[model samples]
Target: MLPVTVEHAAQTPSIFLESAYFNFVLKAVYHATKTVLAFLQRDSVLYWPFLISTLAIAWLAWRVGSAAPDPGTKSSWRAFSRSHLSRELWWHPSARLDYRFYVINGVVFPLLAAPFLFGEQVVANILNSLSTTAPGLAAAGTSTGVVITLVFTVVFFVAYDLGRFLAHSLLHDVGILWEFHKVHHSAEVLTPMTTFRAHPVDLLVMAWGGALVTGLATWLFHRFVHSGITFYTFLGLHVMIWVFSLIGNLRHSQVWLSYGKTLNYWLISPAHHQLHHSAEPRHHGCNRGFELAIWDRMYGTLCVPTDVPGRLQFGLGDDTDGRWRSVGRLYLWPFRLLAKRVQGALQARRA
Candidate 1:
């Protein structure tokens, strides 16, 4: 949480000095490039198939006149691209910053957060060892074992999803955490890369929350009532996650795809997420759940797309202007703001 001090800022010029520091930065960038490219893998929502699926859905929306006032699905690719991928949208400064974040955070954040991650099996074993009795479901492959796996897989998915919702809600509701989380809300534009436009602290909170909940749920299941949902995998994630990810990338894009009123109440549509990013006051802090609308519905943060059909602005409040556009500021300002919060709290305590 060190501040980007005057002395530290002054050293920026040394980056071009051709010294060991420059070489190190070059190596980091090289690895980071590869990391950014890895987003195309099956495990990622940015995988080619998933992105293509998103485009297909968006195209369908255009054809049905669901995306805009006029249907353009019948238009040429050039026309569609001009409308959806215009320079004013995709090439906007805010989205450019997201691209930078994806590259930098890809290599840096994982290395920083690796030590804090938990291995699910290891966590399950530890939990089992602490108990006096043997715990675990019937071994894999038998009829009973198959039943245990099938039932608990759904349980594991729900538990993991709940964890995601809880973690996201906290990042929005908690003041101290919200400063770091602002890096995400600062995006004035959304793209698939916006999925990776997260601060490391934000990412850490999500990763830890997922691991802890899933790990504990797995342990409890392994004993019919002890298991990890890791047994089932589709495209490198649990079946639920994989299914949700089919349109997950669209959540961070300009497409206004909704599952309509009925399903929207039960599941999160990309439009549910778009409303979450709305700059309108009422939309702020709404629609925090990733896959389920139940949490938002229970907590009363749900905002169905039909509620506001007019044009919606994105980003933090208008005062932000372009201050968050700098990649360096996006990374450093969270620490500065957080430190200021701590300092102010301490001063108030003394008074």
Candidate 2:
């Protein structure tokens, strides 16, 4: 107590760190485990209900898929297993990258990327500050009326769908953004886990886009109508989104469940998404919408699927697909490509 010592001062930080490090590690592990466990819950695509729905749809697709016989329906179980479920396809080097991407994006990406994510509520609050509305109109904090709730539900759902589709199209059309999104399109084979195989940057962009549009819609509703309305939900999810989740898993699978020609014009089926994944020249940038076809149809990007299987091939269809077969490269290559583009631009400018 009488004399200040350097050893004592240095030891204080070490002692405090040693005391806290164990609990910090334990807390991190606990949260990560909890997040991974959510994969099995109803909110997730890997949930039993969704997976079972995919199976039922697949079986039905084989027995009776379209109004008429579909070429995809003629595909045998052996062909489906070989393409989608085989030891070769599932265990391929490219699919191994997807597995690693799934783990990283699921367990690690959310933690590191949370601070970068924009919340729709936050966006709405910002927009609300810029606009003036009658403050005394209805109770601002409380919700009322099932009809209003249902309408809000549909509106919010459409907002989300529009945002998602627009973001997806931009990722295809924009050169700079495509560098990051290319990680997803590089998958050679599709699986349930492939749905999770996205670069964290890709997820961040999509999240921000969704938040901005949905938040804009939220502000409009609050300004014109009342802030006392909320969307209807099913099991803690938007009713429309929960319904979409039933067949969502099949979108990245080998299963072909088309909504037929007529509905295909209005809706996007699993077949539509498979075409989106296809590396063919004509199929590139086609069917980018998640559920609705109107966005794609209006944009001239819609390609109504004909339910023919085995015609489409996946991946970038070039050397990059093989070169980025490792998960580490999948993460780093986008940055490297961006750097190269910057370097090239500078050199050209100097020349």
The candidate that wins on TM-score is 2
Displacement of residue 234 (Cα, Å) in model 2 is 1.2
Q: Where does model 1 exceed 4 Å of error?
A: 1-34, 71-79, 133-145, 224-230
Looking at model 2, residue 333 earns an lDDT score of: 89
Number of colliding residue pairs in model 1: 11
Please give, for residues 1-351, the per-residue lDDT of candidate 1 as tens digits. Answer: 889887776676664365667766876886676676665677777777788888887777666666664544445666567667789988898998888788778778866777887755666678878873764455343334666667777877888888888889899999888998999998988888888888899998888777777777777776555333345677567877787777888898777888887998999898899889888888899999998899999999998778436566888875874689888888898999899999999999999
lDDT of 2: 0.79
TM-score of each: 0.84, 0.87
Candidate 2 residue lDDT tens string, 1-351: 547577776468777697588766775686567656765676777777778887777666665634114457345665444545679777878778777777666666766786798778999999878655546344345557777777788889899999999888888888778988888888888777788778888888888888999999887887666675778888777889989988888788766678876999998988899899988878888999999999999999999988465556888766676677777877888999889988998999999
Candidate 1, residue 7: Cα displacement in angstroms equals: 42
lDDT of 2 at 175: 79
